[model samples]
Target: MPLIRYRTGDLGRLLTEPCGCGSQFCRLDRVKGRIAFRSALPSVYDLEELLYGMDTVLDFSARKEENKLCIQVLLAEGGTIGPVREAIEARFPDALVSVSSTLCLVSTGKQLIN
Candidate 1:
C-alpha cells in the first residue's frame, strides 16, 4: 500500500532531520495561519462550525473601535488567536473583527485581529 500526499497549501517549514525526542518522522513547524490569504475566510454557511473549531476561544465582546468592529476573544489558550481571527471573518463577512494586544479583562489568553 502507498500513502497519498495531499497538498494543503500550508505555509510552514518541513523538518527533514530526526527529532531530539527520538521520532524519525518529518515534522512540520510553525503551522501558522491559513494556507492562502484568499482562503482565510470560510463560507457563511460553515461559519458556526468555524467559530467553534477553535479550542482556546471562550467568549467574545464586540464593539466599534475606531470605526472597526473590534472583538476580544476570551481564550483558554493564547495560541489559538489565528484560527479565531479567521473564523470570525468567515462568520461575519460584513463585519470586521480586530483584536487588541491587551488580553480581555477576564484573563490573558488568545486574541484575534482582522
Candidate 2:
C-alpha cells in the first residue's frame, strides 16, 4: 500500500533523511505532546516528561484553576515530596505541586485537567 500522511495528534519533528543506523524510513524525533492538551506555558505531556525524569514521581497531572497552576502528583512508595516539589518549582516557578497517592482520570483514561 502507498504511504499516506496522517495526523497522530502528537507534536514532533520528522526527519526525512536516512538514519545513521542505515534505515531509509523517516524518523520521528521527540514527541512533545498531544495537540489537545497544549497550554500557555507547556503541555501536560511536556511536564510529565520533566517529572518522570525524577525516579520518585510515578504519575502526575497539571491544570489551571482560577489564576494558579496546580499540579497533582502520585509518587512512588517511600518517595519524598521535597525533590519533586523542587523540580517542578524550578521549572515552573509559579506552579503549586501537590502530592497524592492517586490522580483522577478522564473517561478516555488520560489524566484529567480542568
Best by lDDT: 2
Q: For model 1, what is the alpha-carbon lDDT of residue 36?
A: 21
Writing each residue's lDDT as its tens digit, candidate 1 over 12-89 gives 667888999999998766433321223343321133245446676554544444534455665675555777777676
lDDT of 2 by residue, 1-114 (tens): 123223223456678888999999988665654323225556545676798899988888767766568889999999999998888888777788899888888766766655
Which residue pairs clash within candidate 2? none
The TM-score of predicted model 2 comes to 0.67
RMSD of each: 13.4, 5.6
Give the C-alpha miss distance for residue 62 in model 1, angstroms.
0.7
Please identify model 2 stretches exceeding 4 Å from their true place.
1-40
What TM-score would each prediction reach against the true structure? 0.35, 0.67
Model 1: residues >4 Å from true position, as ranges? 1-53, 94-114
**Best model per TM-score:** 2
